[model samples]
Target: MLQSLVPLLVDGLANAALIFFVAVGLTLVFSVLRILNVAHGSFYSIGAYAAASIGLWIVSSGFSPYLTFPALLLSAALVAALFGPLVERTLVRWTYGKSEAVQILVTFGLFLILEDLQRMVFGVQSLYEDTPMALLGITEIGGIVYLNYQLLLIGLAAVVIIGLRLLIRHTRHGKFLAAVVADREVSQTLGIDTNRVFIMAFALGVFLAALGGALATPTSGVAPGLGAETVVLAFAVAAIGGLGQIEGAAIAAVIVGLARVLAIYYAPALDAVAPYLVMLVVLLIRPYGLFGSVTTRRI
Candidate 1:
């Protein structure tokens, strides 16, 4: 039983790491901006494409294989720098205070546009650039061989969670964000630059999404429809965790990851729907999500 459970635990953690990145980003954006960005997944795909392309170029140019690690981070940063501000300033900024339907429709249009752009630029073929994975080698645990890169991902996810918690709880910027989250009008009245905060928060969210995609490229490769699939799963995670809850997102990711791994092991036919099934159960039990609470608006 110990031996069997080891592989399951490893696989689940690895999967959870990727899901946590995107889900956390999604929830963060919603928490601060109060906008559910339908196009957030496009940033993920763009980051994957950039990382794979950069890694491939590095390998073909005879650069040190170790550079691929930095390349993944660079890809994410580049995506955030390039698209995050632009989207937040133009398309996303317009959706503020709008109805949910309008916000969804506008972002969905952006998603379609970005998807087509990716297809045109990168072509429809899937691209694989696993140089980092190759460099990291492999390890054995409980008689099961696992990619060392996978373990690295698990560690990185833990770092991100801790780092985010510290940032939110200890940093001055975190204080500003917390103030804004608690009361946007009060924050604005207190001389906080709400617009700047919104832009920064949105950009950070994009960075997290892109980072997830960049990291995944070393193992999964990038394809045309990857963003769509990722977005759906991310939404399920966000819903299960209760939107806008950071710790909830992390816990939900683990739950979804375990569900997926278990499905793959025991019921292959349920693999794709496992996360959604989990989401269904969670929603039924807690309509506002595990960490979410009901809000009342003044008339």
Candidate 2:
């Protein structure tokens, strides 16, 4: 049991890393915009499609398989760079200072539009490119074989956590973001361009979500409904971690990840509900979430 558990934990973290990106993006957008953007998941699928396409292209063109890694990041950057500001400027901007219902509705519409656009561009067929994963090969840990790519994801997640902390705690932009979070009106009065900040943060959120999808593409198929599934899990992670809590997202991702892997390992029937069940329990125990505080949004 002890040996079995180590592989389970490692697998859980690997799954959690991808989920963390989408959840953290959602949480970050909510923390700053004070609105839940329902369409954030669209970016995830878009990223996956982009990555898979690029990866396949690289392979078909007889390019170095090593390019797959950069292709993943580039795919995400392309999505964010192209659609992020457009979504914010046209749709999200309208939701500013609006009721939660209105915000959700607007983003949901955008989500539908983007979803259809993706189908039109990439078709309904599922797509995947695993050269990146194959190239990295596998490693045996504690007698259990694990993908080296999986371990890389864990390391990447750690770096993201540290990078985000430094961005929030030590940068000038971080101070502005904090100011806006603490008191929007005061920050506006203090000469901070809230609109610019909003755009940047939303773009960052898009990038993160896209990156998650991109990274997962080598191992997972990109399907039409992938975004919807991803968004739902991201929501669970965000909720369990406490809305707007970055660290909370990390912890919640691990908790959710562990629950998922454990369920898959033991009671396969419970795999689907595991994350939400955990979320329900966490929220029931701590309304503000594990890392969330009632006073401030921290994601």
Candidate 3:
């Protein structure tokens, strides 16, 4: 029993770790900006492409293979820095005070644009870079061999959860974000620069999404349509957890991850739909999500 379960648990947690980054970032942006960014997954793909490209370049250029580890983080940061403020200020800000339809339409259009951009820039071929994974090697647990990089991802996810909690509960910027989430108008009235907050929040969201992609690049292939697939999973996660709940997102990611793994193990044909199935059941029961509730919105 332990032998059979160990692989399942390890794979599930590893899957959840990547999903958590994207889901939490999506939830965070929605919590702050009150907008669901359909284009958020584009950043993820871009980051993967960047990381793989950078890692490949480093190896080809006679650089140490270990540099690939830092390259993952650097790729995420670069993607966020380049596109975060740009998208938030121009496209996202325009959708503010607008209808949900308008927001969705605008973001979807942005998603299309980014998708095309990715195809044009990165081409349609799948890219793979696994230097970091190779460097870390593997570990044996429960009589099973598992990639150490996978375990590292699980640890990283836990650290992110704790780090985010601390950031929100103990940091000054977190206070501002909390205030804004509580009452945007009141936050502005209290002299908080809501615009700045929005920019930072969006950028952070991009960073998280990109980081997920970058980390996953070592274990998976980066292809043109990866963003579309990831965004759907992200939306399922966000919905299952409640759109704006951070803790909800974390829990939802685990559920979705486990669902996917289980499906792969037991019913390979249902692998793709497992997460959505869980989302459907959860939504049918809770409607507002596990961690979400009915609250009055202030215009």
Candidate 4:
């Protein structure tokens, strides 16, 4: 029983790690910008594509294989830097005070444009870059062999959570973000440049999403329509965790991940809908989400 459970637990955590990264990023951006970005998942696919392309190039050029690990991070940073500020300044900023429907429509248009751009550049073929996974070797856990890279993912996710908590509690930028989140008008009145904050927060969100994609490239294929699929799952996660709640996102990711793993093991047909099922159940129980609370507006 222990042996049987170990593999399930490990797989669940591994799944949760990837989901958490993207979910947290989505929630973070929503918390700060109050905008639900439909195009966020495009950044994830772009990162995966970038990492795979760069890793492939490194191998072809006879560079040190160890460089592939760093390439993953570099890919995410580059995507965030390239698109984050540009999108925020041009498209996102315009929708600040607009209705949510307008925001969704505009971002959906952006998503469509990005999807086409990805197809044009990467073609329809799937890309795989797994040097990092290959280099890491394998380990035996509960009589089952597992990739060391999977364990590394679990560790990295934990690190990101802790780092975010520390940043929010101890850093100046984090304080600024908190203040803005608490009261945008007051923050602006206190001389905080909310525009700059918006850009930084959006970029950070892109980085997290891209990082999730880059990391997953070692274990999964990067293909056309991947962004759409991911965003749907991400939205389910965001809803289950409660939008704009980081801790909620983490817990929700874990719950969704476990649900998925269980479905894969016990009911293959339900694997695809596992996360959404979890979301539905959670929303039924607590409409505000696990960590979300309804806020009353001051008249």
Candidate 5:
């Protein structure tokens, strides 16, 4: 039992890391923009597609395989740079202060459009680019071989969590973000340039989502409906963690990931529903989530 549990734990942590990236981004966007972005998952699929295409090109061109590692980051950066400001400035800006229904509808429409666009561009077939995974090789834990890339993902997730905390607690931009989150009107009154802050926050969220997708591309195949699937799972994580809580999202991701791994190991039929089951139980116990609380919002 100990040997079997060790591998499960390792797999769970790796899965949690990927989920944390997208869930944290979703939570961050909600905390600052006050809008739940229904289209956020499109950025993830776009990043995966971009990274796979770029990585394949690099390999075909006979460039060093090590180049694929940087390509993942570059692909995510490119997606965020292209879509982040454009979508936030034009569409998302319009939804501010609107009803939640209106915001959801508008962003959902964008999600549909982006999904169709991806189909047209990348087609229905899945794209697989696993050079990075192959290059990293494998590691032995409890007599079970696991991808070294998976271990790297676990470490990367830790770095991101710490980095985000430092950015929020210590950096100037983080303070501006905190000010806005505390009171948007008050921040504006203080000449905080709330609009600029919104744009930056939204873009940062996009970068994180894109980075998650780009990193996943080396392990998973990129397909047409991946965005929709990812969005649902991400929403579950965000809800379980509380809509605006970064630390909550991280913890919730671990719970969901462990639930998933356990289900896969013991009862394969329950694998798909395990995360939602955990979410249901958590919500039943704490509707606001483990770290979430009700707060009055300024109109």
Candidate 6:
């Protein structure tokens, strides 16, 4: 039992870290931008592809191996810098203040376009480069070999949670974002440039989603339809924690992670439905969400 337990917890946290990144980004977007962004998953796959490509280049070119860490960050930055502003300015901006149906449709359309663009650029086969993982190596735990890279992921997730909290709570952009979240029209009336805020929020959302993808590249394969699978899990996390609650997303991620782990260990049939099952129960009780509340929807 002890042998099984260690690997299970390790696996759960590893899975949780990636989903946490994507889910938190989704929640943040909803909190500030108020968009469902069904296509948000595309950014994830793009980030993963970017990371794998960059990591592979570094190794193939004989660059210093330590660069892989920076490569992870750069992959996300590159995706965010390129696609973030472009998508926001062109398509996402058009959906602002639109109905939920329109927002979903536009973003989903963008998702399809971006997904195809990735295939055109990278082709359909999977890509992965684990220089980072190779550097860290492995650990022995409970008769099982655990990758140190996995633990690194958990640390990364914690840093992101704290970093995001500070970004939203301590910084100027955070205050502006908070104001937007509080009341968009009022913030605009108060001389806050809502358009720019929207751009920033959308870009940040892209950054987080892409960062998640980039981080996963070292351990996971990047391929077509990857975004689709990841998006469903992220949506489950986002919904379970409450659409706009950051802390809630984190806690819910852990719970969902553990639930999945337990399902795989004891009741394999529940593995797929575990997270959503928890979501269903929580929403049934709270309606709004565990962290969500029925409040004014004015934007």
RMSD of each: 0.8, 2.2, 0.9, 1.0, 0.9, 1.6
Candidate 3 lDDT (Cα, whole model)? 0.94
Which residue pairs collide, candidate 3? none
RMSD of 5: 0.9
Question: After aligning candidate 4 to the native by TM-score, how far in Å is the CA of 132 from where it should be?
Answer: 0.5
Off by over 4 Å in 5: none
Estimated TM-score for each candidate: 0.99, 0.97, 0.98, 0.98, 0.98, 0.95
294: Cα error in model 1, Å: 0.9
* Order by lDDT, highest first: 3, 1, 4, 5, 2, 6
Collision pairs in model 2 = 244-299
Across residues 268-295, which tens digit of lDDT does each residue of candidate 3 receive? 9999999999999999999999999999
Each model's lDDT comes to 0.94, 0.92, 0.94, 0.93, 0.93, 0.90
Instruction: Name the best candidate (by lDDT).
Output: 3
Better of 1 and 6 by lDDT: 1
Model 4 TM-score on a 0 to 1 scale: 0.98
Model 4, backbone clash pairs (residues 3+ apart or across chains), number: 0
Candidate achieving higher lDDT, 5 or 6? 5
Q: Which stretches of candidate 4 lie over 4 Å from their true place?
A: 297-299
Model 3, C-alpha of 247: deviation from truth (Å): 0.8
Residue pairs that clash (backbone atoms under 3 angstroms), model 1: none
| Candidate 3 residue runs with Cα over 4 Å from true position | none
Worst 10 residues of 5 by lDDT: 290-299
The CA lDDT at 120 in model 3 is 91
Flag regions of model 2 displaced more than 4 Å: 295-299
Candidate 1 — which residues are off by over 4 angstroms? none
Residue 184 deviation, candidate 4, in Å? 0.2
lDDT of 6 by residue, 68-171 (tens): 99999999999889988898898888887899999988888888888899999999999978889999999985569999999999999999999999989999
